[model samples]
Target: MLLMHSQVKAKTPPTGLMSNTEQDQQFQVLVEQHKGILYKVAKTYCQDESERQDLIQEIMIQLWQAFPRYNPQYKISTWVYRIAINVAISFFRKYQRRKSSVDLSDPPMYITEPENVEKEAQLQLLEQFIHELRDIDKALMLLYLEDRSQAEIAEILGLSLSNVSTKVGRIKEQLKRRFSNHKI
Candidate 1:
């Protein structure tokens, strides 16, 4: 159970406006409602447990900063996804530059093995296949697997609808080939 850091608590608006408790409450609710977005993004981009926690904190801080300026017309989930994905990409890139060693043996912390051994192996393979994708494609696939609409994915990724569709089809084919090649 992650709590908001004190540093990210509601701050006075820049225009000499006092902080509104009501607005703060609203922001808190927004975060509570979409908290999974933070975790999923963090897990996808970070392999280390501590790094994932740091990434989630970073995402929360950014979300707090941007909350006041958030527009109401757009879907909240879409807004949250956009911010989380962008932060994860930047964080991953920074960590990659500083990383000294690669650890491929550890499974993602978010994955829980199913009862069936074959199913668990396939799930692990799928996760590996997803992690191999380019950053943008990885974001796209995450959103897609979450069952977001193509229109929503396009909006989140700032790609054209056709482009989103084309890339998704290609990624699916690539994953299929990987699985096929793994078979004896």
Candidate 2:
């Protein structure tokens, strides 16, 4: 089980006025607590390693900017997912526009091979299928795959609960067909 980093202590700033150091410490703690979500979002949206890293950095920056306004009423994971997914979608859109003219025929090679080749192959195929999905569907599938509750997924994605349920069913059927058709 992954554990969040211990919170760092900083001198309390005046009410409604966080010192830079205090703000940094607070942001660091939040990021440490939610970094896996950020990475998963980045990876789902970006196929290229460099682009994935860029997306992660961009998400962190956006999260930091939005941290001060975060409402404690909502779960932190919900807020993080909302921001991370938005940033990822934006990043992907910009990246697609920029790369429209570039040749993407040559795929980047992975340096380290997984010890379990069969499991890695299956994961790769799943990722490929996920990348082929529409943006909203991709986000839905990511949250679903994480075993999040339908209500939580709906809240994070700003969809009605019924809509989330319907979309999840459709997405699962789509994945099932893809997996059945492809011998991965």
Candidate 3:
């Protein structure tokens, strides 16, 4: 969670200034469309319900603030990802500055219906292991889970293509090692 970083360009900048009704409608639509993406990404970043809720709210507020500045040069999904990841990363830093390591022994306080609830136990263990990872590795895994191609991930992360591939490979090996050696 130590990445020292860092959106789709809005198709229109609403030059004339949108009325409250139109702005509210657009905000509602965007929230409805992107909420799941934000949740899944946020869930991967934080292990606790409180942190997840706070992070998502911060991300949404940032997104709303950023709307006016969005350039119309890229996909909206890309822009949203940028904001989501940035928010998560910042939250991680803030948490670390306050308390560096999270204690997993605190109990499973935040259990949503996972894609594979049958494997929730394993998923929780894996989540803890992944949380122990370096910040760049966490970022890479998030992009991978989002199904970003290596090239696309590289672009978003500003990494060389080979660097992305190599780092991902190493992270996989690290995950495998941790899983096998894990006590849980």
Q: TM-scores, in order shown?
A: 0.76, 0.78, 0.73
- Runs of candidate 3 with Cα error greater than 4 angstroms are 1-17, 91-118
Task: Please tell me which model should have the higher TM-score, number 1 or number 3.
Answer: 1
lDDT ranking from best to worst?
2, 1, 3
lDDT of 2 by residue, 1-184 (tens): 1112432211221125657776676777777777789888888888886666667777777787787777666777888899999998874444453322212222455635567676667778888999999999999999999999999999998899999999999989998888878875
Q: How many Å off is the CA of 101 in candidate 3?
A: 27
Backbone atom clashes (below 3 Å) for every candidate: 0, 0, 3
Candidate 1 backbone collisions, by pair: none
What TM value does model 1 have? 0.76
Q: Return whichever of 2 and 3 wins on lDDT.
A: 2
- For residues 76-183, what per-residue lDDT tens digits would candidate 1 score against the true structure? 788789889888888444454433232223344554545666787887788888888899999998998899999999999999999999999999999899999998
lDDT of 2 at 14: 14
Best to worst by TM-score, what's the order? 2, 1, 3
Error of 3 at 123 (Å): 1.6
lDDT of 3 by residue, 1-184 (tens): 1111112223554224667666656665666677776887677777777666667777777888887676556556667778888788774444533321322223454556676564777777777777887766887887886688898788778899999999989888888888778755
Top candidate when judged by lDDT against the true structure: 2
The pairs that clash in candidate 2 are none
Better of 1 and 3 by lDDT: 1
